[model samples]
Target: MTAKLIHGYEVVIGFETHTQLATQSKIFSRAATAFGAEPNTQACAVDLALPGTLPVMNREAVACAIKLGLALGSHIAPVSIFARKNYFYPDLPKGYQISQFEIPVVQGGEVSFFLGDEKKTVRLVRAHLEEDAGKSLHEDFIGQSGIDLNRAGTPLLEIVTEPDIRSSEEAVAYAKELHKIVTWIGICDGNMQEGSFRCDANVSVRKPGQPLGTRREIKNLNSFKFMQQAIDYEIRWQIEQIEDGHAIQQATVLFDPDTGETRAMRTKEDAADYRYFPDPDLPPLHISEQWVQEERAQMAELPRTMAARFVADYGLPEYDATTLTQSKAMAAYFEAAAKACGQAKLASNWIMGEVSRRLNMAETGIEQAPVTAAQLATLIGRIADGTISNNAAKQVFDALWTGESNDVDAVIESKGLKQMNDSGALEKIIDEVIAANPDNVAQFRAGKDKAFNALVGQIMKASKGKANPTQVNELLRAKLAG
Candidate 1:
């Protein structure tokens, strides 16, 4: 919808992002929470909801929640309590989820992110600590359903944002920015495919200055593309209902990727309806101020700050800076290459262009990069030292990828790929080219720049494309002009 129509009908979005903590054990038990395990094998007494098995809080999970709160500029609650969210599902063995209700571990935070050209900030309502539910696999071939408890009891930090988002674009941007932060901070892997991190977008459309419309929550939007699509479709659907003089109902919906639409799962349930009550087995969590301070001190530079530094310190364009700072690994690679080659722009070009292109083609990520920063820096140094032509340097990079060698000098020498920088040798090649292309030489004398270019091409070909281009140009100009 156009902004004007959207202005008449505000698009309000709130995000409930579940980020699985990077811990070795389950939140309330000693059972391993590792992914890809056999179904139901990871479940222990606590995870299986066996009676008389009390819950024990994991200190590491609480620490992770605090770290995330500090990163989001949120206040760490001095005391937070865990309550049982009662529900019945085949996947949920406990018949209730142990989660924070009115008292969250982190409260009143703000996450700053950008939306296109405009800088948008979203207020965080709270980030609560919770344990994840299990997964159900249904297939017709099996003719029966299966349950996987490997994901059950995994510690998750549920970050909730206020209804400040105005469009699907903003919602997607917020999710992406959050993903970057959590991944960079080493708190979560942010692998949407593996369900390490996921988002549910709550969408509602209202007339400007009117009371907010009844919101629909779209769940299980794991990927960023799906998040955008699901929210976009939900917003339109709500607007259609309002236009038809029907009031929108608050409900939980699921996005169908095959149909590109959201279908209602059930009516939204309020927390009181879940019969929230403190678990008598577990004690309330008390986060000391010193602990929060320590985590804040350990945080590495965030993406936005790092991107600005790339612009200010390295003199990179905004786009280049953004590209380089997208991931911690890419930024580290650029920094090492820049330090070695002593050329920030050139280092950025190689990393963003050739390195990025190759990684995308191979379906690899920066973490799985074949070329290390030191190797890339060394290769770029060869070009700077005039040891290899730019085209030849690319060949060296390819060789480096195949376990050949990263030593630029060694590769050039072993392959006999060094540029012919000797003026006399270039002059002889230019002489041979002039002797063969008398017509082109005459054309150059007639002030035809194109003819001189053609002659240069022949000289480069005669040298097997190893001639220094600058030397070829100078020698060609002198010989042909004479």
Candidate 2:
């Protein structure tokens, strides 16, 4: 999809994400990787790089990498090497981070998602395994900073993407799809607020047919809402700098949520500056075909695959299938409801409409929905069997949602909401409505559609809204024709 140009210049974006693996131990040590632990309690001798302590790779961390490769349809490397990414900081006890450089475990994949009904794809360069640095805390210290090494050596899969993103909206869509994929595969928990998933966006802008502009990296966007805001502000800032005759320099920048702007942090470093060298302490990692196949065999059904099944099996629209498969829980709930009620389209409509609306308003997830799938099936069944009208069914749903009643039939019975399906009984009311409203009858026969709706409304009111709307429309039209 073409991105709408901003100030006659097109936006281009790429992304790098750090996803903390779901292993219980750190990537290169036996230290616990649990969050919120006392600053140094979880940091072992290996993680702290004490003398004579050599790094030992965690088997579970490597297993997480294999699952990610299969999930993205990427190549699982038979042989990959770890390198020392040399850098210096207070929190980096080893003075370098152990990461994959020349030979990454996962290579060459694409993430696809829908942007306003148009499908957008982003190409991935690589997803390399790495170790995290500890954090520096300044809030609690005076004229100094405290270091928390609990996060150090935590396993991370650094996923990098090509610059195929065109706009902030597209970037968000791509991010969301990738997030869904990683969490769905169970490699990462995808808790952005807890720092399990973090994104760095490379944003630039240029003329429609011109070469790509120099890009700046916006670092550590933890939430999707903040991500879009940062990208947009960066796009405008870059365009303005170029308009003022300033050359766009390559650098790393930080987004300030309070200011809604990005400020330069430092110049971006090239690979040569990192002084990458293969780690001599550990041997090259090797994986056999059998290991990759084992992981694949144990994996759950992927989202896109399940969506296709939903379309073919349930005869659902592509949009409905895609939306329902956004999460595993959502998909399961929908399937249960569909199977119980025997009406796929009707179940989809209620789920996507009323169910979703209530969920959002309450700031809750589908799993927390007070109305169970079995309860929804019962309510839908009442509507299908002509035991209640749509309007009346909504009341029953509200009663069910708020715990007013546990049974669909009970709600309908107590409220006197049963539909007037008897043709003879409905016909008497239809005749009375026609006799009292002559002008509307003449207008209807004169081919005015509003007159037909007016007569239908009067019949519903006269029947105290118990009339089945579909039945009323059919019988009203038949009597008028006679």
Candidate 3:
């Protein structure tokens, strides 16, 4: 495949995401990891890295890492090492962060998703276990900054992706897919607003066939919209800089959503700059094969596997299956409706088209939809059994969605939406339509398909759109032939 070029330069992007694990306690301490706590209230001795405090690994945090490995089809290492990432910040009361450096818990996985109609896969470099540093509160301090240690020592799985992403759209899609996997597996809460899931995008641009360009890291992109905007602005900024004879420098940048631009924060650091050394406090972490097996046994049916099953069993298109299984609620709703109605394709179409449109317009999720799966199933069944036309089904759906009626049959009956299925009655309407439009009859007999469609439309209109379309077409053809 040819690389997509932007203004004669190829854009390359990589992601380093910090996914906060859902564990209640800190990674090395018993301090609470809950959000929105008072400053310094949740910091314990181990979290603060006080003298005589030895770091003890949290068992639940390791279990969460194991679950993430299972979800992503990554290699869960039997043994991993912890290192101290030395840094200076007022928020880092420990003066150094305990993180995995040499060997990570999860390694070598690929996340696949559809970009438009094309499927794209992003390769994972590693997901290392790390502890979050405390947050620095700069606002409302009257020129003095306050540190919030409540978030200190929060367990984090820093997932690193390869530089396979070439566009902002693909980057956002990859982030969202990763978010879904982490949240679906119950390893992370996946909240971007509360800083549960944060992303750092390394963006660069180079001329086609040239070596990779210098990358500047965009730190702490908490929202997908800001992520794309930041990458795009950064890409353009780099391209313009190179064109004007300014060399692109490696630095950490921050995205200011208010101004829709990226500004340099600090020089990007390399591995040696951090002076990584194995932590003496914590010993080498070991995981038995039995533990991985236990985690696999407890895993739920993943979206990818479920989508393949849908394609095989339900005879749905790959796109339909993938879209339907985007979330557990959506997948369950689709499966229930498809099974109940025995019209998998119809159920998929309605859910993807009308149902999704309504949900997006309302800025809500499938779990909060007004129409129940059973109700939608009954409506689809009515359409399949020729009890109502497609147009009538839309009307019934609107009533159900708007809470105008709870019962499917009640809405259909109340709105007089029953299809005119009687062969004799439809034949009468077809004969009248044929006689009333002699020209259309001549044209359809002369092989004008549009004329046939026009005649069907006339018959449906004559029946007040209540005619069974199949019956009308058959009777219309027979009358025209005779």
Stretches of candidate 1 exceeding 4 Å from the true structure: 1-10, 113-120, 139-150, 207-210, 297-322, 379-482
lDDT of each: 0.87, 0.93, 0.93
lDDT of 1 by residue, 1-482 (tens): 33434525888889999999999999999999778887888989899879888889999999899888877878899999999999898889999999999899989888766565466788999999999999999888969988887788999999999998888898888898889889988889998999999899889888877887789999979998889899888988888888888988889999999999999999999877899999877889999999888887888987777888999999998778877877898899899889888888989999989999999999998778788888888888888877788899889999888769867678888999999988888888888899999999888899889998999899889999989998788877876656
In terms of lDDT, the poorest run of 10 residues in model 3 is 137-146
- Off-target runs (Cα >4 Å) in candidate 3 are none
User: What is the Cα-based lDDT of residue 440 in candidate 1?
Assistant: 92
Cα lDDT tens digits for candidate 2, 1-482: 46689999999899999999999999988888878887789999999888999998898888999998888889989999999999888999999999999999999988888887777778999999999999988975467789999999999999999999999999999889889988999989999998999999999999998999999999999999999999999999999999999999999999999999999999998888899999998899998999999988999999988999999999999888988989999999999999999988899999999999999999999999999999999899888899998889899999999999899898899999999999999999999999999999999999999999999999999999989999999999999999
Could you say which candidate leads in TM-score? 3
Error of 2 at 9 (Å): 1.6
Candidate structures ordered by lDDT, highest first: 2, 3, 1
TM-score of 1: 0.78
Candidate 2 residue-wise lDDT at 228: 96
What number of clashing residue pairs does each candidate have, in the order they appear?
0, 0, 0
Task: Using TM-score, rank the candidates from best to worst.
Answer: 3, 2, 1
Candidate 3 lDDT by residue in tens digits, 49-136: 8889998999999999998888888999999999999988899898889999889989988899999899999999999999999898
lDDT accuracy of residue 148 in candidate 2: 90
Which residue pairs show collisions in model 3?
none
Which of candidates 2 and 3 reaches a greater TM-score? 3
